[model samples]
Target: MSNIGICEYVIGVIHDKDIWYYVGRYDANGMKLKPNEQYSSFLVDAKRYNDEDILREELESLPKTLTYKILELQRCPKCTKEFTEHPALSREDNETEICPECGVKEAIQAYINS
Candidate 1:
């Protein structure tokens, strides 16, 4: 690759607004990076690799579905326990997964754990 390509690299999600985006060096195929990587609010389209135009073209593409699960504390109707970050999802305006069974489990576990 070129010097710019080796110095700068980006990672992004398939769909949904990225909560976390990462960017950093590619390690030069045989080097190591220090201090890990950096996070950015704006993400680069992963489809763009080697050719920025391809990524730019892919920017119009959207994933069929997208969802996010957050663990939050809640009292389970069954277990009556609250867990840390137990998810209590409600679909977002953009089709994000708002609630999930894992959230219920985590909430109950958190409640029990506490």
Candidate 2:
């Protein structure tokens, strides 16, 4: 299987043709090499093999921007209540949790009467 998400690549072999190259494969999980999971590739030569050393470097970087995505969305201006990712509010008749700051007071009043 191919590597998904972030993973490690293994240097399975080396090809010394006209161009010097280091071949390797992506390891699924962080573990000692196993026979079946191994694959092959042409990375950099001996001089730039340190490129593989940076494998774990990405983990040191800052996290994703998703937190800003969720936080940046506008909440209700009147009530300051953040809009959740849940389904939209149902008809007033079917629900009782009204946003007192923004709900139509007359509509809620009529529903309360009937």
Candidate 3:
């Protein structure tokens, strides 16, 4: 079975010299069997700041120039893992409660069964 997926994006912006620049983004994808529920993935842009400390340092360096906010957070039903995006989950209706890794296993099992 094919599963459709949905995603939500949280954009991070920094105001420098009155110009707002997009520094990064967080993408959250819906989970299988729970289309409405979304989770955050570790995947992020902002190559200059890969770690939270670095990101914070850069933000703090600019003081009033930097600001950020999280739109939401979601948890994986199968693994209980929290993420900004669950790209591996399925948003299709009547889907099973399986994460991306487990979903791959399920596909293999189906292939073998067939």
Off by over 4 Å in 2: 1-72, 86-108
Q: What does the lDDT read for residue 99 in candidate 1?
A: 33
lDDT agreement of model 1 with the native: 0.36
Error of 3 at 56 (Å): 15
By TM-score, how accurate is candidate 2?
0.18
What is the lDDT, from 0 to 100, of the residue 37 in candidate 1?
41
RMSD of each: 15.4, 20.0, 15.4
lDDT of 1 by residue, 1-114 (tens): 123212222334323444533333334354444523433344331112444444444434423243322212233333333222224553223232223564555567668978
Clashing pairs in 2: 23-41, 24-41
Clashes of each: 14, 2, 10
What stretches of model 1 exceed 4 Å from their correct place? 1-48, 64-114
* Candidate 3, 1-114: lDDT as tens digits: 211233233334423433223333323332232311121222333223334555556445443534553322234555654334343544334464446665566667668988
lDDT of 3: 0.40
Largest TM-score belongs to which candidate? 3
TM-score of 3: 0.28
lDDT of 2: 0.32
Find the candidate with the highest lDDT and give its number: 3
